[model samples]
Target chain A: MMRHWPIFFLTGLLSACGGGGGGGGGSSAPTQICTELNTPQSFTSVPLSAAPSSQPNSAPVTVEAYPTYGNGNFNIPYVTLQVCNGTHCVTVDHVIVDTGSYGLRVRADFPGISTLGLPSINNGSTAPIAECSQFLSGYAWGGVYSATVKIAGEATASPIPIQLTNDPNFPNPPASCTSSGSNIGGLNGLGGNGLLGIGVLIHDTGPYYACSTNGQNGPLNTPLNAILTNPIVSFASDNNGSILVMPSLANYPQGELTASGTLYFGINTQSNNTLNSTYSILPTPATGGNATFFSATLNGQAGPYPASFLDSGSNELFIPPLQPPGTYPLNSNGDYVPQSLQTVSGTATSLSVATDTAPLSFSLLDVTAGVNAGNTAFYDMGTTNSATAGSLDLGMPYFYGHSIVNGINGAQIQFNSTTYTGPFYAIH
Target chain B: MPYRYRWTVVLVGAIVTGTTHATLGGLERDVSHEGQPIAFAAATVHPLPAVPQGVHQQTILNLRSITLTEYSANGTVFAILWSGPTMPDYRSLLGTYFPSYQQVIQTQPLSPGHYRAPVAIHQPNLVLHASGHMGAYQGSMYDPSAVPTGLSITSLGIEP
Candidate 1:
């Protein structure tokens, strides 16, 4: 089992900071196996139990985990793909559609994908390439490979390159990446087949490297092939960007088990992908540059949460928890609110958003409340922050009934073609 | 109780030049905790089989992106560090210390734009300091009570 596969994604993440290594004179305890955090549950693709009518879009997007591979609490959506070398294609399902991360990472030995005789991506070296993808808590270690990745039956432009997790070529993860992260990439630890990150970044700046047979390696910069790339930017026809269209369970407390949705490719290429003229743009943050590529402000307060991006990979509205936890108003059900009506000067409190000052007011929900309860989707909600590095991850719950658009990093979409660069996010 | 807001140090110290917080990748000698600050006469490039055991001797283990050195007190773990590709998993590493912070994670809101900057969760029992991205994943936490009498946390690689 090539477990520590995702470590290559965050090569210098630690070194980039000024410190290196822990202190001495201490008896190091063996890292205890966290059964709760590392439980490998078998999840099946349960049909959308409370299935909503499928939205009018091209491809089928599912929030259901493949049976035997469900990620415990993260309500991430999945899509299937047919990756091939010409006609010898294998259909790989459960690819996470992530807007938070950049590029594609698939399990090298995943059940069906390993069968395909995909070519090794050398990144200019005869020796194989490895990557250390740093997650907030851990890293994904894997190697690079080449293939044509198709979504919704349409082929991505060129021979789409991707990260082959747990590269069979370099099954042994170096001690460096493993000390910080887990032994999961794609199918092993992470609950999906592979991830289809269609966010704005064209290439993942997360680290990748070339490895020698005896385990010697270094930082690699072979741009076109070494990095996990966002395929939307590589598409020939609808080349601009894409949008996730999910219906609003606005009032549904506990979200439905299976909410049918569609992930439309390209923002304005087709009739249904047009921008909603009446909607205001929240603007893709130029906040972290590369760090926190999509940061957001809570209420009117600004950020310390870097890694904040619209993610379909997460399960809830994951932002830094507000202090005191009392400033926000609670609804009758004790659920924190997204927008509430309160009369400022009168003797009564209004309970509707139409009131003058209640348009985007949001609140937190009870954390222990299972997503299946009537208290599923949360907007004003924010949860605990990762002490190591903080981020405000807008998980799957943020997509309830919203059409979030990501304009590719350099590609322009507006009719003017020059107003906005690719890599900006817009919600309608 | 004041340490619960140790985050203040994280915010303010980031601006202070040369003050060690938890920058793992560039970790240097024990300036704060050491009887006197000194550089590694010879740094080991190979990784240790497991974290070595000792309180006074520095056990440096090299990993891909970062290296770790553990500070000990009579075989009791006092501080654990990380510096490299990314940060370590605090949930698992922190063990019992994680619950309280997880339950009542409170921080004073700062001016705008500092939101994504970095934060320090200061508590009496355990102090957590972290920040950075790919090349800069740095952070560390230690129990003040767990430290042996003469040792300083700064000497253990954490900034006071």
Candidate 2:
């Protein structure tokens, strides 16, 4: 896809030249093209912490509008990761800190990962077990391998199963996997070194569990332990959930260059990770339709969308359009472009307990302005939600000023004198 | 009992080719001919209640955790709704239209600040909406021209 950019540029130039030269004595204003502002050389790495904290439960997270690696990403929280098998260890930087999916995935082409020689999980067959981790618009297909995953000072007690996306051993993914969507298994498409999914779910199953054997579609017969397991659940302690704390980008209208925060591993288990009374706990069903989704209602629209969720993986706040589709102008990227700043407000109610609701709101800005301004972190960025009418996805922008807690399924959580089970979200 | 048993055999045989051939704008029979061996490893077919006057709806539950619902009218399939852990095999589901959909998606411009937005395509004759994360996903696609008169696709209750 990146290779086509030059051809597109050439075509645009030819068309512009023809339009200008064909007309005599007629003048047209030069078109303003919004391109990526940050060059590869201008990119800089977010300095890593001096040492792994002895706290063993928290890690520093950094958000850069222009990261040193991959494409320039915005509002994406990243953390450094250390993967080790016996003595061979490789430390990877700029791994996405996502609370929308489970388990950890690293690019096979990432530095030192392939050389780490992580043991492949075969499930007793000579054929390596491969998986297709599907996202909304893309997928990562690769072999399942085991390695000790460490974030800051916290490490998985045992070598947990992880997906080495784009594993060379499985170069050609079956048609079933590739047919799903674009392959974001590389740095450019993924926009990061890898993904560290620490969402509400403990195990990533469903279509993700349909593993292929030696490039052929087949049933995954591997045990749960051997599947791509969430490393946070494997921690001896602080195993229940995680908290993403990003600084408020409210003051930066044009957007900030870099924002830093903390990712705590547990909920209410440590003083630094405790859930206080100020937080509203929204419980989601452990099973059945839209398991981790709660209900939300946007102002001036319908009452409640039953499948709403808080997803860090999504870069923008996705909701039903406030007006009709054509009401607001759209930029080339399809993001809503209001004539002026527009504010959309809503309320997210607990699926299990309707009374437990969290007030939500965000501004929508002109996408072209933000891009032209050369900023990565925009507070007032959003797009329309077209997938499910009964759902709204409040993305990373919602987490900027709040401490959002994600409790894993079946984990016990005590907050404000109430004992709540796992599979819940608390907004503070 | 014999009639039902024979119907099961026919369904299994017809579905073997369903995955690669079933598509919007195709005949209703095309859906019956579509099936994925992995999803069919354990499959259940459920007929949904008809809503409007001329539409027929059916939901196919794949053991792999995906559900595909087909809407047909006058023997033509005009719409499809899918919800599950991963996206359905669109190559088979969209048939000839897959390439057009793929082209529109691939050619869409990418803004550095926002890259992970949901996919929504609204063509003159075709409309598509798809989005989700890892554990949960849902989407719907329909042809406006083939749909029965006075019927809205949203009236089909196509929530994932």
User: Distance from true position, residue A264, model 1, in Å?
Assistant: 1.2
Which whole-number lDDT from 0 to 100 does residue A84 have in model 2?
93
Q: Alpha-carbon error at A266 in model 2, in Å?
A: 0.5
Model 2: reference contacts kept, as a fraction:
0.39
Q: Which stretches of candidate 2 lie over 4 Å from their true place?
A: A1-55, A66-72, A206-223, A324-333, B1-21, B26-50, B109-115, B158-160
> What lDDT does candidate 2 reach at residue A166?
69
Model 2 chain A lDDT-worst window of ten: A34-43
In candidate 2, what are the lDDT values of residues B34-132, reduced to their tens digit? 432122212111123346766765555433346677788887788987766656667667866777777776675433323356778887676888766
- Interface RMSD for all numbered candidates: 12.6, 11.3
DockQ each = 0.07, 0.27
- Considering summed lDDT, which 10 consecutive residues are worst modelled in model 1 chain A? A33-42
The digit string of per-residue lDDT tens for model 1 on A235-335 reads 55565667788776655443455566788876666786767564333334222223223323344444444334556665555444444345544444233
TM-score (all chains, Cα) for each model: 0.61, 0.81
What DockQ does model 1 achieve? Answer: 0.07
